[model samples]
Target: MTLRLSVISASVLLALTTHSIAFADDSAFEVIEVTGHHEGSYSSVSTDSSTPQVDISGLLEQLPGAAVNGNGPLTGIAQYRGLYGDRVNTQVNGVTLASAGPNAMDTPLSYASLVNSERLEMTRGIAPVSAGTDTIGGSVKVIESQASFDEISGKVAAQYQDNGQRSHLGAKTNIANQDHALLVYGDLLKGSENTTSGSGNEIAPTTYDKNIFGGQYRFNLGDSGNESIAIGYQHLETTEAGTPALPMDIDFIRSDRVKLEGIHALSSWELNWHLAYSDAKHGMDNFSQRMKMPSMNARYNNADSASFDGAISVGKDTWLFGIDSQLSQHNSVISDPTMAMFNVDNFNDVQDDTYSAFAQWQQDINQWNWQLGARVKHYMTDAGEVSHSMAEMMPAIKMLMTQFNNADRTQSQTGVDLVLNGRYQVNSELSWIFGLARKQASASYQQRYLWVPMQSTGGLADGRTYVGQMDLELETAYQLELGADFSSDKLTISPRVFLHRIDDYIQGVPATDPAVKMAAMMMGDDNPMQFANVDAELFGMDLAAAYQLNDSWSLDMNASYVSGERRDIEDNLYRISPPKVILGVNYKSNNWLARVEGLGVSAQDKVSKTQFEQRTAGYGLMNISVAYDADSWMLKAGVNNLFDTEYEDHLAGYNRVMGGDLSPGERMPGTGMNAWLSGEYRF
Candidate 1:
């Protein structure tokens, strides 16, 4: 039977290579480096791989103004130093997860799944306000994995690559009777993919699936050690594995979540509380194809979403305070492809709502240290469309169209956000940091669904309706950050610099003139949408260092650089930051571990052609990994793109009728040498 299951998977990876962690006498299980900051003197990097699809988003497209649009097995809506869409913001454990194509090339926890994370936080720019509200290009968090005492844990994993193969299994349990505590966990996964492009051509072969479940409970009211209460529940489902000539097709996605928390202590302050709720459902199937039309275009859609959050906290002198709230709702439907022809029908509907409230503070006033915040938000939208074409046909198609209607439009917004931060202590090694922030932007649902496609050849254009301009304001931003961090006794340096500004920066222009481009399409209100208040800028600089040369060795490095543009036609506005430099090297003992990494990018040449249909050209990459550990089971193995080079990223998208390049573009496509093995067991 396949050689007794390959000798029981090599004796269970030689008994987890001999035990997961021991660290030569350091307990509390070392290895915890989590730090991320935005604003208040932003400059962050506290390693354990700066997450982006489980690790550095494929070496950050080899720096130098990075770019990656699409290619294969993609997940990781990347953008760093140059930002993208909705000003980048992602959260988990602090809520916020909603996105299923409204186009930013998809990202909202990227189809969820990161091997049961227990820490992953990233903040780029103009952040801080206690990490909530429209972040101006930054914020990513995921923290999951809980259970302690009477521990009962489990994991099973599998992998294969050349474009597909993955399997996973999980289990967790923790219970303590005597003070009341309970915890439970579950996981299941599946994956498949096939891709090859960027001058190798093979495109399309995808399959991904996942399911997860969770539970947690806690209680304690004695021991004068204060008090505690916690409750949680989670459920998730995912699906989508069909691609090639895409026009949309995804028919499964579900989520359900609940949470509650509390803590207490008196005699001089200490209190905390939180609440959460979530519900999601998404489905899709839509296609389009033309160019010698023989008819073939389908449609079907669905979306249902919900969200809520609440929080409170307190403390003083040296400070710590909080108050926050959030709410979200979505409902959508689309079904109109000539209603499967013959006795036609059509449909479209939409609704969206959002709300927010905030207050926060964090402080220290000796060598200087601070944080402050504020926020307010409210938004709403409603949409509708209908058509019942050709009832019982003929009779000149029911007298040239007997049914058509549209009515039901609404949009609303209310916004506010502010923050300030500071730090100092320019001695004993070094320290200095600064921050300032502001975010304002509201009303979005694809700019209120605006479509205009009719460049001749069997038309369907002349649909111009967008009621939102209701003095549509908000969409303002301001940012400033300065940095300094130094250490000695085995190195640890840091450097940071940033500047950002945006005002009425909601862009989209082109209302073609000359009789609306000879009446080719988009009429009403002279279509050619508008939302302006332009003048944007971004500045960047980042440098990091790490060193430790004893007891097992260590070394690390970092680099970053950015320019400007959000508008003012900065000559096709380049800078979507990604390159400047980044490098690394590592080696360890006590069960062996090794690593080598490099990435570099430059040569953009002031791009054009819509920035080369989403920039590219500038690459360098190399990666290597080695793993081992032993005792009570735990083992790992690795080999990834040791040199298969070919790159692009920035959630690539653009294919002006297939000549703009970037759709099905090249990204994370350097996997010619790949390998992985994992094993674990504990009792």
Candidate 2:
């Protein structure tokens, strides 16, 4: 299968290359100047007619050094360089959305619906401190449609795909006068349990249905100010969604959110304020999506969060400052209807609060642009009384719980961040960029408060159980980056190299205590681990290039490579992405456009034995798309994974679902050939 796909891809590439026009000296894309003095590897996504209604992680994959690790259709976790999850900060309209599920079934990007957004941007390498607090990975920002007063506008779109029998419909409208405006949007998506692997075998428990709706109201303040209030709600229902890396299957996830924002302009400064609140409820079970075990167990978890932010900014070469705060609470419970006395409280009254203050200074000196920023943050967590039915059955466990309950259950920590960025233009067509930063992040609530072994370690899905360390110290990172951008009439290229060293990096390792291992064995548990701190280092390089072959054709390419290892021991880090490359050709005419691309990933042999990581083989995929535009309507059609070659992703989690050809510990298979069509009408 792999050989067949590679031959097909090579033939397509040869055909496209032979038909290309003569090379010409011209820019491949229009260059847009940034409004601020920020310096970094930044890219903006086009939200025009050609963009599809997919998750944020899917869109981010178009950029260099980015990948999406999927647990479900909507649960796409963004990975950049060699880090992911909480290490990266995602913001929608300058507000952060907290995950609702303990296993991260509802990721931060899950809240930002692509149907209602207008623009998206990503910052690569070391991000500025002003972007957000605790940003060791990078940042993703999304801007939603805003109320317009110039005229009334609306759009309706629909799409269908054959892989999972998936369907989507969305509509949005804006109504406004000279003094006030209102915008409303809604979307519906549904799919069946028919997702097929590259081998044409159906993957069970992969169906879902979801609905989203939101509205925003804006009122004109004076000449250059406005106040807006917005509300959003999302409901997701899953019949048998599988989490191959974790222990359970998701049954349902429901979330609701509200936000209020106001901007006021003064003589030489602008004041901005925002407030947000969100609530999420999730349920999971072992029998719903896979083979039923003797213990027909079910679990439910609920989480809620509230946040506030305020900032004041002056003109360029001035100062900007702000303060932000967030508070969250979590609770969980388990039940078994067949057994009368089978009940457990996994988590109870777990609360966390975070507050931070930041300031930034940007200035332009001669031919150089520079920015300096700092942030201070305080974090605290407390867990009320916790109990479980298993503890009661085991006297040794009961004694450990008694001691834990009597000890102090509250912890606090404070950390600081500093960042500096500079850019220098050597000539009109070349620029040099450099950045340095020191960042810190406190442990999560699950890492600091979990009393029993569980599978809630940031959704690693590694099929390992871990216990929390209450006295864990904060993790700190030192990072540096250097890059250059070269642009000419017919070519544009940007390349960057970065290095990161972390102190007291937190990770899960094998639990070696005799008594703990004996107790776990007695409870029918294996692969017991505990969270510990170790030093680590990572280095990587990313390159992106584009060339214009003529007025009707263009070529683009991107490549990324990264490596990570434990500094204190001779072992490799876990779940790091292997080297990858993407190449594409695009042809455009008066009213239509067509594109073809090939993507390839190299084999990953650097496995981490302590984490029980496995190696994966290499694979390549072929894709093609075409689109056409009329007076007020547009249509797009595409096919992905054209060869249906069977392969597994190095970053994918293990297969845990029963009643399948694949074993429990085997890597999950990638999706097979899929064809889709979409259309939109605007007024």
Candidate 3:
């Protein structure tokens, strides 16, 4: 039955492409121009009348050197270049978002709902300190849709995809009469059976449901000033969602979020204030979503966070300053309901706080534009007290716990970051870009306070248990970037390359201490590791180009390559993305559009022996899409992985879920060929 469906979808895609080619004409089609400060750094603005109401990670994948690491439909993590997780700073409507999971099951970007957003932007290279604190990798921002008008206007949309059996519906409306305006929006999304892999096998336990609603009001004070206040709320629930990379399966996850924002404009100065809060409760077990073990193990975690930020700006050659603060608390417990005696407190009353102040200056002189920024941040963490159920039965484990509790449980650090960027327009069709930055990032809570050996090291999913380092030093990075942009009437191209030198890079190294090694072996574990500092270097390049083929057709291509190695050790960095290229052709008419694309990924042979990283073979995929417009309505259809070729991504994590055909250490398979149809009506 699946084969028949795949064949039918392939035939339909081919027929649509043939029809589109025959209908091509000399009529000129509009092309969106890409804007950027350098070759590796660019910005994209959405022009669609209504947002897709999908996960933000999927949208980010359209950019060069960007990919998504999938654990489940709602647990996608964004990867850029060779870095991910907290290394990348993500924000929504200029406000920072915090992750609510110890293993990062809910990434920062996962909270951003597309229904209320206008555009998404990313800075690929070393981001300026003003972008955010601790942005050693890059920065991503989601701009919310604002309400403005002398009249009333609104839009509503709905969509469905068969691959995940997902459905989304949303609506937004604004009412204004010169002096005052109000905007309101809402979204509903649900999905099931999201585990059908490319090999016709179910991955088990991938389903989710979510709802979000918000509103904003604006008041005009004068020609040069205005004030606005906004409020938003979101709730999400998931059932039997599997994280094959992690040790446990998610039986349920409940999350709630609330946000409040205020903005005031006065002459040449603007003032912005934001406040947000989130609470998440998650549960996992060894039996519900996977095979039952001899001794049932169940875990529960609760996390809550609050953030506040305020900024002020003035002048076209803007000078801006801001202060941001965040506080997070987490607690985790493990138990076997079947056997009440097996219960422990894995993490108890863990608290983390971050406070930062930043300043930025932007000015243009002649043909040169320059930006300089600086930031100072402070971090503090406290793990009140912790204990385990087995500590009483094991002398070595009990001794370790006593030492951990007696040590300094409270730790703090301070760091600074600086950035300088310049762009010189040599002529009308060409520009030169250069950037230099010195950035610093403190270790994550899990890296510094995991009192015991566990698989919670930023979700590496390498099947190795790791212990935290309480005295680990902060990581400092120095980066240099150079690139250029060129454009003509019928062609446009941008290319950039960058080099990064890192000091005190934190990574897991094999444990050498006799006591620690003995304890790990006694606990039925092998190859135990501990976090330590090391030196590393990374360099990469990104290229993007587009060419118009006559008036009705266009060709677009992009390629990315990156390499990373430990300078102080004889091994490569773990889980670096392989070289990749994407090529696409498009045909457009007054009311119809068609596109076909091919993506290629090179084999990854630069594996990290120390981390036991696996090498993956290269793979390619074909995809086709078509869209049509009729007055107030629009239709879009697409077929991805058209050939149903089974392949595994190099960055994919291991399959830890039990009762699967694949082993625990094998890589997860990619999705199979799937077709989807969607329609939207503007009213």
User: Could you list the CA RMSD of all candidates, in the order they appear?
Assistant: 24.5, 4.3, 6.0
Residue-wise C-alpha lDDT for candidate 3, range 1-683, written one tens digit per residue: 23323333442243223222111122111122357542235544352422233576666655666666666566767777777777778887676655656677766776666667766677856687767777897887777777674658776767777767878887888898777778888877776665467788766555666666767676665664366666666666656666767777666666767677767765667777777777777776666666765653555444434434444333233677778777777776777766677765566777778888888887778998888889899988888677877888877667777878999988899999999888898999998888999899888878887777777666677878787878889899999988877776766676778898999988889987665666687756678888899998988776666766666787766667778889998899988877776666787778887778777777777878888988887788998877887787788777788998788877767777666666667887776777766676665
Each candidate's number of clashing pairs is: 25, 2, 0
Candidates in descending TM-score order: 2, 3, 1
- List, residue by residue over 1-683, the lDDT tens digit for candidate 2: 34334433443354244322112122111111122235345764545533354455667666677777777677778788887888777787677766656777777777776567765667866787777766888887777887766459898988888898888888889888776778888878777655788998766656777777887777777654343333333333333455655667667777777777766765667667777777777777766667765553544433333333333333333677778877778776666655556665566677777788888887777777787889899988887777766676776556556655786888889999998888788887888878899999888777776666677776787887777777788889999989877676666676778998989888887877554555556656676788888899988777666666777787776667778889999898888877776677777777787778778877777778788899888889987888887778888888888898888978777887767766777888887988888888998
**Alpha-carbon lDDT of model 1:** 0.50
Q: Which ten residues in a row have the lowest lDDT in candidate 2?
A: 24-33
Q: How far in Å is the alpha carbon of 543 misplaced in model 2? A: 1.4
Which segments of model 3 are wrong by more than 4 Å?
Answer: 1-33, 37-41, 45-54, 149-151, 176-180, 217-225, 295-316
For model 1, give the RMSD to the true fold. 24.5
Whole-model lDDT per candidate: 0.50, 0.71, 0.70
**How many clashes show up in model 2?**
2
User: Ten-residue segment with the worst summed lDDT in candidate 1?
Assistant: 453-462
lDDT of 1 by residue, 1-683 (tens): 23323332332232233211112121111122213332343322221222123222332343222233232243444455666545566666666655544332134554344445554445534567666666766665555654443344544433334434555556556766546677777666665544443344333344566676887777776564257777878887767733322344345667787888877875577777778887777664533311112353355556566767777766544445566555555554555556654322212344555566666676667887677778777777664542333334333223212221232356777777787877677777777778787777664555543322111100001112222232346677788888766665656655567887777665444444333232323221344333334567777665555556555655554556566565666543333543444455556767666656655555343432222324545565665655554555555555455555555432333221122223332332233434444454544
